[model samples]
Every structure is written in C-alpha cells, then in structure tokens.
Target: MASRLKKKCCTLYEAALEVVTSRYSFYKHDLEMLPDSVLFDVIYEVYEKGGIQPLREAFSRVDIVARLLKITDKRFCLIRSFQGALTSMFWEEVPRGTEEAVLQSQFLVEFGGGVPNSLAKGYENLCADLEDTQVQVDRLVETGLRLGGFLSDAGWFAESERILLACQEIFKWARKEGRIWLQILECCQKLLHVQSSYCHFEEADVTYNASVTTVVGLQGDFVTANLAVLYKEFSALHFNRSEYSLAHYWAVESLRAITTELPPCVIIEVFRQASKACVVKREFKRAALLAREVLCLANEVFDVNDPRYADALMDYGFFLINHDRVRQSVSIYELALDIRLAMFGPMNLHVAIAHEDLAYALYVYEYSSGRFIRAREHADKALFIMEKLLPRNHLLLASVRRVKALILEEIALDNMVHDAGTHILLQNAEELHKSALDLALRTFGERNVQTAKHFGNLGRLYQSMSRFQEAEAMHLKAIAIKENLLGSTDYEVGLSIGHLASLYNYHMKKYRKAEELYHRSLDISLKLFGESYSGLEYDYRGLIHVYHKLGDIEKVAQYTYVLNNWKIQRQLSLIQEDDPLDSVGSPLPIADVAALFFEDDLD
Candidate 1:
C-alpha cells in the first residue's frame, strides 16, 4: 500500500480512487498516513478529474461503497457534495463536441455508487472532460467535513460549526430546482438540521410536512421505487405529527400506487418500506403480500443468491413469522441467510441481523417442535459478533444479550439443568434485560415502542418464576410505556392489556383485573379485526376462566352467547403470535398448535 502511494504518476488525482477503493472497498481507513489536508486533497483531485461516476464504477464491493458514503460522517459529506454536484449538472448541456451523453438507464446500475459529482467509473473518461477549475469548493467542503472527524471528538466547537455551515452551502446548491426544487430545497434544509442532530423530532414533523407538500409530484414513471420513497417520507411526516390514520392510509396508498408502474428494483424497495409500515400497524397480511411481490420480482431480476434477493427473501421470512407461518418463515430466513453468508460473508452486519431475527423466529417455533438448536446456534453467533463490534453500553449490544438470554432460557428449559446453568441464565437474563430497558429509556425515551418490549420481557420472566407482584409491576410498566407512546385506541396500546390481564387472572387470582384486560383486548380485536375473528377466542377463553373463577353463571352464559356467535372462528385457529408486547416469542410455542389448522390439507 505504501509502495502504491509513493509513486507520483498521474497527478495524484488517480491516487484518490486507489485510496477510496482501498479504504471502503478493500481495506480499513488507514490512520497511519497523511495529514487531514493531504488526504482531502486526494479525494478532491480525484473527483475533479474523474467525476463521481467513475468512482462509482470502481466500487464492485457494495458494502464498502455504502459504508464509505453512508456510515461515516466524513464520507457522507463528501458523498453529499458529489450528489449536489450531480443534481446541479444533471440538466446542464455538455459542451457540444467534447463528450457523448450518458443515459439515465445506466445511472442506477453501473454508476449508482457515485455521489452527485460522479458517474460510472469508466464512463466519465469517455465523456467530455472539460472543467479543471483552480479550486473545487466541493472538495474544500468535503475536506472540512473530514477534518471534523478529528475536531468534533476534541470539542473544537467553533471550527466544527464553521465546517458544517460550509457543507450546508453545498447542500443548498444541490437542492435548488424550479418546481421540483422547492420541495427538494425544503428537504435539504430539514436534512441539514437532522445531520446536525441539533433539532428534535418536533422540528422534523413540521419540516417534513412542508417538504412533503411540495414533493408529492411523483412525476416519473421510471423510478417508481424513488417515488414510493418520497411518499413514504410524506407518510412518515404524518406519522411524526401523530396522524397515524393518515399515515397508514398514505403509506399503503403510496406503496400500492407507485409499485404499479415502477421498475423491479424500485418495486421491491417500495414493498420493503411498506412492509415495515405494515408490520408497525400489525397489518401482517399486507406486509406478507408486499414481501411476496418483492420475492417474485427478485426472482425475475436478481439471482437467487443476490443481496437484494436475499433482502426480499428475508422479509418474506419475517412476514411468515408475523403471520404464524412459522415453518415457512424459518425456511425463508435460512435460505436468505445461506445466500448472504455465501455472497457477503458471515461477519457482515446484514448477515448478523438476519441471524438474530431468524434465531428469534426459530426460538418461537421451537415451542412446538424439535431442533431448536438452530435458534440457539444462530443467536449465539449473533451475540458473539455484536459483543466484538459494539460499545459496552450500546442498546444494540444489550438487545443481542437479550437474544442470548432467551436462547439460554430455551436451553435451560429443554435440558435437565440441575443447578449451574439455571442460576447463571436467570442472573444474566435479568441483568441484560435491565440494561436493555435502561438503554432504550435513555436513547429513545420511556415512551418508545422498544421500552414496552423490555418491560414485557422482564414481566414474563417474573411470571415464569411465580413472582406475580414483580410480574404485574413489569406488565403495568409495559402497558404504561405503550399507552404513553401511542394513544389509547391505537392497536399497540391494546396488546399490553392481554398479558397484564393474564397475570391478573393466571397467578394473582384477581379475576376482575384479568377480566378487564380480556375485555379490552377483545375490544381491540373486535375493532381491528372484527368480532368474528379467530383471535377473539383467546379473549373468550380468558373471560371464561375469569367467569369460572368468579362463579358468575349469568355472565359466563352471556360470554357464551358471544362465543357461540363465532363457532366457525373457534372450530379453526389462525392466531398470529408476533408480539408488540413481548421482546421475545411467547411462552407457548404455537407452531405445532398452528399445524392443526392445516393438518387436514397436508394429510
């Protein structure tokens, strides 16, 4: 590497490509050589000479390119400069005779890796290479951002602010447009605030609304995926403002609308984000449909082993998980994991996350089947890698620990653990869960959807040990977190009532409390799904138990009337076990139980 840099041919501009390729694509960021000014010079010189397209073509390693551009602040600034430059230059007429036109079709594929200033690696060299300004301000701004790496960590407050403002100027230029430009400009302003992390979500709500109002043109039919993203952003703004009904309506509409005319890639991504929103709403059926569409499209466009294909496959797996298609979910996640490990390698973060998610799914299914060892193995692998990469107090690390603890819980329950493993598992599980809760409360605040999960997990742990008081306290905390985060009528707030009620009835012998929770949960089921839904059976069972405990024959008969009304729903089962409440899967693994629903078909 030293030998390559020492040779001074090709104006050192060529060296920038080498540096980028090595740093992001092939090697780590080398701190050993070059001052900040000197390093920035290389990146600037390269951008000036070759443009952004060429740098992108050089990026065969997708992860490296994305990491260099997205993960690090320095790279993000530089990438933004390139992006701004491209947006500015996109419509500019090339000098008539010097270069051939680069079509938009090639933009997404070969040169897609570049920032605004660049094109595909080799393509720019063929195009007119006319401009060599005395100073590239874009480069200078990028250099300042790179310098921030050293400065911000040291609290060089004034210098960092100045550097950021300089970058913002470039941002403003990039976002400028005539009609489309207005929303683009607004988006740039909001992005600036967000990148600074100075403004809160309240600011995001207001700005995002303004930005969305201007940006909903959805003009082009080509990049339908991009249009879907724009609408998703719009929906997100509504979501931020607590207009959830509007948010859901818009998000579903956006995905449904744009995907009708978009390219396959765009279609898949549209579905991915839409699936996330569906998951948030517990609209599992919609999410599953979108995920399947992604899979089908991926099969047409990408190889079975492609990363994007794996992504689609992974989502399909998770959709299966959420829909109570356990066997299918496990298969999909496994296949995706296999492809990712083959193409990207085992240590990749994407692959690691897949392992974690799949492990959880397996753990859930393990309740009713054999070979949960797959779940334990995958979770352990995820835990090991996260512990190596993340900070000691990172919430993600804590989540990984929680995953490990769950796996251990399964192991303890499955094996004949007389003493040592049981004590260790219980001790570690409690500590890790507490850490996870604390970290979530600190980072996301107490009302985050995540805090409810932490509380739910601890609550279940307590309930398992017959610690009803502790269990009730934890369950209430979970309920409180959700009720505060979402409104009383939101689907999320309804979930806590079931478990908290279960504790009230199951162990505390408090029939009234359990009855109340059952009624509330049933109300949500009736509202969201309708009274004829199969899920209402759980509510019925809970109430039956409550009435049995109370010796209330009249009320029990009244409940029976409702039960009889849904005999078709009861004779069959299709309850989904995916939880907004539990951080982990349920205590009762339902896969085998679910299998009964399809048993006749299979037979």
Candidate 2:
C-alpha cells in the first residue's frame, strides 16, 4: 500500500513537473532534476513519516530548497508557486466526499440513538458561542423534520419518535431563546401528528396542551387560524379513538375558530369533520346542515369535474339520506356517481364506491317510487366491482351485498306471481342477505350494529316469504341485539320494533302484542325525529290495524285521523322551492301505499 501510494504521488509529481516546465522555459532542467535532489528525498521522508500535512509543510520549505540549489529568490518564488500547485492537485484527489458521508452517518446515529435531553443544555455545554448554537439548532430542526417524516413513512415509528422528540426539545430551546411563535407552532404540529397517529395518546395530550399554551401566549395575526388547525387535529385524534362527544366538542371549537380569511378548503374540511362527529352522535339535522356547507364550499372552490367536488357531493348525499330526504339524495348521489365515473373510470375504487352510494339511495328511494330496476343495476355494478377488487368478506363488500339484496327483494316483491323467475330472485336475495350476514359476523362479530341490521334484513325477507315463525325469531334477535348495543330508544331499535310489530299484526294475528310494540316504536320515532317523521306512518297504521282486529271502531278512526294528518304534514314538508327533486305532493306508489296499510314494515 505504501509503495502504491508512493508510485501514485510520483506520477502526480511528474505531471506537475511537465506543466511547470512548459510554462517556464528557464530553470526547466534544475526543476526537473529537483525530484532526484536531496530536497525530494527529505520531502518524501516527511510524507512517509507524518502524511499529507507534513508533506505539504515540507513542500513549503522553499528557502531550504533554494539554499541547496543556490537559485535566485525570483526563481525560488516561481518554484514555490509550483510546489503550492502540486499540493492543491494532491488535496483535490484525496476524496473528501467520504468525510461528508461520515458526518451524515454520525448525525443519524446521534439523532436515532441519543437520549432525550434539552437541546439548550446540550448546546450550552458543547457549543463555543451563540452563533454556533443557532446553527446547531437550525440544522437539528431542519434535518429532524425531514428525516422524521421519512422514518414515519417507512413505519419506523420508534426511530421517528426519537428524532421528533429531539426536535421538540430544540423547539423548547428556540422558545426560551425568544424564537418566533410560528416556528414553535410548526414543530408542535409535527410532534402532535406523530404522537396521535401512532396511538401515543398520552404523549399527544401533553403536546397538545403545550401547543395550546404556546398559541395562547402569542398575540399575532394567525392566532385564531393556528388555533383552528390545532383544534381540528385534536378533534381528529379523538375521532380516531371513537370518542365522538369530545370529537364533536373540539370540532365545534374549530368551527368557532374559523375566520373570514381562512381558506375555503380548510373551512370545508373542518365542517366535514364536524359533520362526521354529528352523524356519529346522531345529530342528523346539524350533520345535514354542515354537510351542505361543505358541499357549497367545495362547489365554490373547485371545478364541477374535480374529484374533490365529487367527494363533497357524495358526502352531502349521504347526509341527505340520513336526514330522511331520500328523494333529494337520489339526485345528489346520481350526480356524484356520474362525476366519479367520468373522472375515475369504471373499475376504480372511487367509482365503485360512488356506484354503491347511488345504489343505496336508489334502493331507499324505490320504496316510495316502486322502481327497482335502476337500483338493481347500480347495486349489481357496485357488487361486480367489489367482488373483483376486494376480499370475499371485506366490510365494504358486505354493505354492497346488503344493498343488492334489498334491491333484489324489492324487485321480487313487485312480481306477485309465484313463477320461476320470481322464486329465483327471492332465492338470490335470501342468499345475498345470508352472505352479507356471514361477512358481518366474520368482520364485526354478532353484537355489532351491522350484524343486527343483517338480522333485521333476514326478518323482513322471511316475512315477505310467508315464513312467519322464522321471521318472528329473526326480528326478535334483531330487536334484542339493537336494544343491547344502541339502547332501547335508538332509531335502529325503533325500526326493528316496527318490523316486529308488522309481523305480529299482519301474519301472527297478535293484535295486543303488535299494539304495544307499535306504540314503543312510535315513542322512539317521535323522540328522535319529531311528529313530522314519515316513518311514524308505518307504526300508526300498525296500531290502526290492531284496533280494527279487536273490533274497536273508535280507536281505528282515531289513528286514521292521525295517519291522514301525518300524510298531509309530510307532503307539506317535502315541498322545497329550490329543489325540483322534492316534487311537492307527489303520491307514493301503490307498493309503498300498500305498505302503509298493513303490509310488511321494513323501515
């Protein structure tokens, strides 16, 4: 290795010798022979003993070389210039890129492995001055953010936590050093994101409190805006934990923090989150209103063709469905589905989801219109895409299958004749409902709301099939699960109760039992959706039928009056001047009207 280095240095020396000799014709021989002179041997010995620095020092000994050669000072100066050039050539060839690589490697080691400590304390002990302290702080902040993000993306949460913790400490130092509040806020946001995402809720709470303190301490232009951001993120954290009440509280706080200067998209996002919390908390009216705001904002900010606008439209459609505006929601769902299909193409997941949304709205709308064809088509499309793309028991697939089953059941019910095609459709519907039930059991177990709904679906299907005993058992199971999971007065429990009452009144001739269940369901519906709720009609009719069975003409006439008033109010409520889909005073189809008059109730 020594000999090879020597040979390489000699080659470099000869190359410099050629350039120098060509540049200066005079003293060329003396300069060329200088390599074989005593000075050359002395310089080589210095290089061999102490390396490049010593070799460079030895090369700078121009006076000693001049004295030995007896050359003029002017010629010695020229010789010194050549010596410097040769030193630079060797210095340039030494590969200093390795040094930078080593520095980076060391920084990562300290970043990932170093103990969590105050950056101020570390800098005070190690840094020579404030300028160096500042430089260190800046480097740590910049690199920590970049590397921490990369580690997070790689799922190296532990290492990412270490780096982000170090960044937080540096941020603490920056705050004490009277750094800008915005900078500290930025660091706090990053730290909170890491903690909340990785289930570090305890640590995240501390960081959130600290961030709130920092924001409160500031008196700046973006104070409300920054608070809005913090509140929005904290709401999401609570949402991730399924703490809907707290999520709604923080979401409301975020909404309050919104300023006129805030971007439309940010406002829309906050409204969307708040609306989600509202939906989960069963605040349907508020959820629908906020969802409309999101849609309006998105429409204002984005092009109609934009996927974001489509997303907003889809969300609004969902809220509309929950708000009991199924007719309006059908149109909204159709628009969103068209946008998604046009932008994402047929096989895309968003397109499939859009189809599923439209399918759901259409399925519900078909109850009023008795139009199952379009609903079945959309349900089939969604089912086809989901079966091709998702796992067999995927949660989304289960939902789509449930919708398809309902659409098929509606079509089968429309066909009154017990022909081969009708029997086949009913069988297919039963299979789909069972398949959905199995998927729900596999994914969410028996106690879940989804599982309860599947039971209720089977109950309705059995009622349609004239399997009275099996229908009663399924309805009982559904009511029990829903009452246990969502409490007795929930909307879902009310629907199940209403269905069970229908089974009793229509098939079992248990008028007194049917009357009790119908009253209980009516109480729930009235409590949740008020007297104007269209669903109340089913329960009222069930009670009227029970009275008629008992030969109580007065009771039947009373309920008939109530049902007529309910229909009148519903028709009035359905009128909306701006929405053509509302179609004021439009009569429900014979199928739904028949349902109102002692038919099977599948609310």
Candidate 3:
C-alpha cells in the first residue's frame, strides 16, 4: 500500500508538471481547473525541480497564481513556490525562507482573501519567535518597506501608513546598525510623502521633524544627500500651501546640499520646483532660465516623449504664456500634446489637459475665425474627456467649461460685429458663462479666486450683451471677492478694477467713475508690476478716453503724456515678438489675466 501511494503521488506530480509546462494555449485555464490534491503535488514538484523559471512565468500571471493560492491545500508550500519564483524573477539577494515569508504576508494583505487572518497570525508568531534576531528584524523591515511602497502607490494611504509605522517600531530595536537605520529613515520619508500628499499637514510636519532629527543624529559625510531629499520634501510641503518664496528657498537649499554624485533626477526636481516658484513670483526671466535647464536635463535623462519630458514642456509652455510669449507657447504646447496623445491615447485625462492648454494658448494668441474654430475643437474634446472621466463638480471640469465659454463669447463678439447670428451666439455665450459660473461656485466656493474670476467673466459677457446693470452687479461682486481674498492692492484687484472701469467708460458713460477706477487700477498695477507692464496700457487708454469724454482737457493732456511716455518705454523695453493682439479684440478673459498674475502649477 505504501509503494502504491508513492507511485500515485509521483504520477500526480508528473501530471501537474505536464499541465504547467505544456505549450498548450489554454494552459492557465487548465492549471486553474486542477483539483486541490493535484495542485499540491504540482507545487511540491515545482519546488523540488530546483529551477523556477516556469513558475516565475506562471506567477507573472497574477490572477492565475492568486487562484492557485486560493485553491491549494498546501498553503505554505504554494507560498514558498511563489516566493521562489519572485526571487528568481527579481534576482533578490535574500534568504529564500525569509523572502518567501515576507512575500506571503504581503500577498495576503494585498489580496485579502480567506488567508489574511491565517497569514496575519503566522506573521505575528514569526515576529515573536524572531524577536531577538537582528537579521530577521532587518528582513521584516525591508518587507514592510516594499509593502508600504506598493500600498502608497495604490493610494491605500492609511494601510501604507500603518505598515510603515509598524516597521518603524520593529526597526527601533536595530537602529544602532547603520544599514537598518538607513532603511528606517527611508520608511519615515515615505510616510512623510504620503501624509503630505493627502493634506495631513500636521502629521506630515511630525514626520518631517522626526526625519530631521534622525538625519541630524546620523554621523556620516554622506548625510548631505539625505539632507537634500529632506529639503525637497519640505519644499513640496510649502509649495502645496502656496508659499512660493519658502518653497523656492528650500529648493535652493536642496540644490546646495546635492553633491556631484547624486542622480540627475534629484537635481532636475530641484530646478523644476524653483522654476515654478519663480513663475509664481513673477520673476519671468529667472523662471525661463530655470525652465530651459529643466528641459535640457530632462532631455538628457529621458526620452523626449517620456511623460516627465512632457510635463517639463507643459510647465515651460505655461511660463511662456504667463509672460505673454503666446506664439512660442503654442509650439511648446503642441509638442506636449503630441507626447501625451502618443503615450496615453486621445481619450486620457492627461491628453485632455494638453488639449485644453493648447486651446487656451491659441485662443489667447488670436481670435480670428480659424483660431476660434480650432480652439473650440480642442475645448470640446477636453470637455468630452473630462465629462467622461471626472465628477460633475470637479474643479477641472469647471476649468474646461470656462475655456469653452470664453471661446463661445469670442464667437458671439465676432458675430455681433458682423451683424450675423448675433442673438443666438449671444444667448449661447450667456448661458455657457452662467453654467461655468455655477459650476465654479459649486466646486471652488463663492469667495474662491476661481469663482471670483467666473463672476468677472460673466460680467464681461453681460457687458457685451448691453446688460449694463447686470454687468455692474457682477463686476462689483467680483471686485469685492478679489479685495477680500487678495487685498485691494493686489494685481488681481487691479484687473477687476480695470474691468469695471472699462464698463463705466464704454457702456455706462460714467466718466468720473471710470476715471477714478482707472486711476486706482493704474496705481495698483504700478505698485505690483512696475510701470512697464503691458497691462498698464489698458488703464492708461481707459483714463485718457474717460477724461476726453468729460471735456477735462487738462487731465486728458496729463494722461496722454503719461501714456505716450509709457509707449516709448514699452518700445525700448519690449523684445520683438509676435503680438497676438495687433488689433483690438474682445475683452480678455478673466481666466487669462488670472493665469498671468496668479498661476498655479499643475502637478
């Protein structure tokens, strides 16, 4: 009976191996269909074969391996087989048993089937048994790190944090060992990144402080590299809070800490953050220089079509657009669009963003029929993709809707000028603007800057339709919000003032009111952007026209002289480039002005 049983086991093992190693097209399905006893025999046979290449290939099919683990009665042997496959696949330099145990625990946690409780209990027992062994503790820490990273990337933030914190506790016992200490520091850094990303600022700060303390305690010349990482993380934290100056300072500190031996990606990130900070600070020349460096470094380290390269291109494009280099921005945006389209296909959210950005750049660059049509096409594509992928109240959806409304408003203006389809175009533009405003208010709240801009946009649309009372109300609401959020002296407040001033001067014939508002705008603009900003021209022209209408010849002459001097300064200072607005066009979108003065970096 014993001889018969041994022969039957051998026969079953051989049959299992034949099913796994056969080149039949449906082998995975067949493997899943095998009975538990035969599957157990296959697991033992595969392990005893001493070569795990076939098992590694099988494990790569995660679903098949998962089902096999689910059905197998010899759970420990099956898990060891899976781990051996992973070791062979990754060429991991660890003991087979320790690695197997770690892999099994992680698998159970991630897959969360009937085995999780058993796996949890087993891990607890193993930890208790190895409480005094430094080697086993170190292995456990590494396992936790890998598992934590996987969970973090999967967006299981709380789970990842729990695992990492548990690992930190285990690591405390082995902290005196340099290798273990470094691993612990890495776990802390990962936890901090996860916390910061989820807006758990208080927790992130605690992690940051703890990481700083750890780095300070470590005794090594190699600590500078670690310091660089800490500084970069702090920079990201400040950047998230819109503290651009602090972000830039920390980014610069990070750069200073980096030695030549550090990877180029680290230096690239520092430059990228610094460039974005400079853009927000309105330090255009410095921002452009840093952006160019980012492009160069990214090109050297990544393919031109790589997603990182595409992001750098988009950032540079936005910087150029902010500085009024619209034509240059169009080409850069096109390159980014091509890369994103190729990488993610046309319907992806990234592709939608690229399309929307390109559309906005083109719309700002020119408002001819051709440009408007093309811009509308891009905007429509973006709206379609966003509507498909995002919730109704997503801020990104509102942004795209605002872009579409701007395009329709411009088209309405065009039709009005030509006396063609005026009523329908105006009606469409008004409704779209209202829809965008409602969406913005819902997503960003009434006092939010974006919602304020939406009100200003609708104000401009109302003015175009000869609804002066509604326009005035909208403008006043926008101004109030701007003043409340940004204070009265901010450039954004200046923009609101200028918009209201234009309404008074052109539509309401309130010359004195227009003159007052224009002067206020001029004062704010000069204080915020200096005298040479191109936007100042709008205030100067408004003031001149208002004074002229009121027959205030003296003030008109004074403003004319100021305007002439400004024109001369502009001529001397302006770099020769394609001016998208050579002729007067419709009122600029509040979104465009907002982009210029308060651009937010999209990560």
Checking candidate 3 for backbone clashes, the offending pairs are: none
TM-scores, all candidates, are 0.58, 0.58, 0.61
RMSD of 2: 22.1
Best by lDDT: 3
Per-residue lDDT of candidate 2, residues 374-477 (tens digit): 88888888887666544456556777889998888888888768678877888998999999899778755787777889999999999988899999999999
lDDT by residue (tens digit), candidate 1, 346-404: 43345567789889888877764545688878987777655543446655665666776
Best of the two (2, 3) by lDDT: 3
Could you tell me which 10 consecutive residues in candidate 2 have the lowest summed lDDT? 112-121
C-alpha RMSD values across all candidates: 15.6, 22.1, 14.5
Candidate 3 lDDT tens digits, 302-359? 6765666787788788787777567778888989999776554444466778999999
Number of the predicted model whose TM-score against the real structure is largest = 3
Between prediction 2 and prediction 3, the one with superior TM-score is 3
Question: Scored by CA lDDT, what does every candidate get?
Answer: 0.56, 0.66, 0.67
> What's the TM for model 2?
0.58
